[model samples]
Target: MVCVANTTGRAVRMPRPGGPGGRLLLAGHTGEDPAPEGPDGTVAIAPHSCSWWAI
Candidate 1:
């Protein structure tokens, strides 16, 4: 899971989880791209949640 602490008083936008195709890391397909956290897509307001897996 990814934890983001925004000390700055501003709303932050993050990329949609898993990017396009919703790719995820697999045991055998380790070479396959495990979608990463990036600065691009949606916005998660406090009290809500943004989720990701770190592989």
Candidate 2:
């Protein structure tokens, strides 16, 4: 799993192991923890809590 942020005006691409069939999960400023199950281990990126980004 990979994570990318476009805070800047640049385009970024994350590589996946299983190619096109791979699944990507994006989590925003939510305070919930992600489930720990997937075909491979799940990948979590920028897992910020709602309170953290409020500031």
Candidate 3:
């Protein structure tokens, strides 16, 4: 899951309930390409921004 903060433009990494090595499933973004890679190979977004996702 990606959490964004609108004002700070920072991304919040939420703790996984299952502990370490948890998996986050991301769906495709319509009208846009896949998320760009980040430091941890996960997509990064600004804090409090609008969330676009799929189940």
Number of the top TM-score candidate: 1
The better candidate by TM-score, 1 or 3, is 1
Please list the C-alpha lDDT of all candidates, in the order they appear. 0.37, 0.36, 0.40
Clashing pairs in 3: 4-47, 4-48, 5-47, 5-48, 6-47, 6-48, 10-47
Q: Where does model 2 exceed 4 Å of error? A: 9-18, 30-55
lDDT string for model 3 (1-55, tens) is: 5422234545544333133443434332322223455455455444545443422
On the 0 to 100 scale, the lDDT of residue 29 in model 1 is 19
Number of colliding residue pairs in each model: 2, 0, 7
How does residue 47 of candidate 1 score in lDDT? Answer: 27
> Could you tell me every candidate's TM-score relative to the true structure?
0.30, 0.25, 0.29
Residues 1-55 of candidate 1: C-alpha lDDT, one tens digit per residue? 3433333444445544444544332211122222343555443423232233342
TM-score, cand. 1? 0.30
Clashes of 3: 7
Global local distance difference test of model 1 = 0.37
Give model 1's clash tally: 2
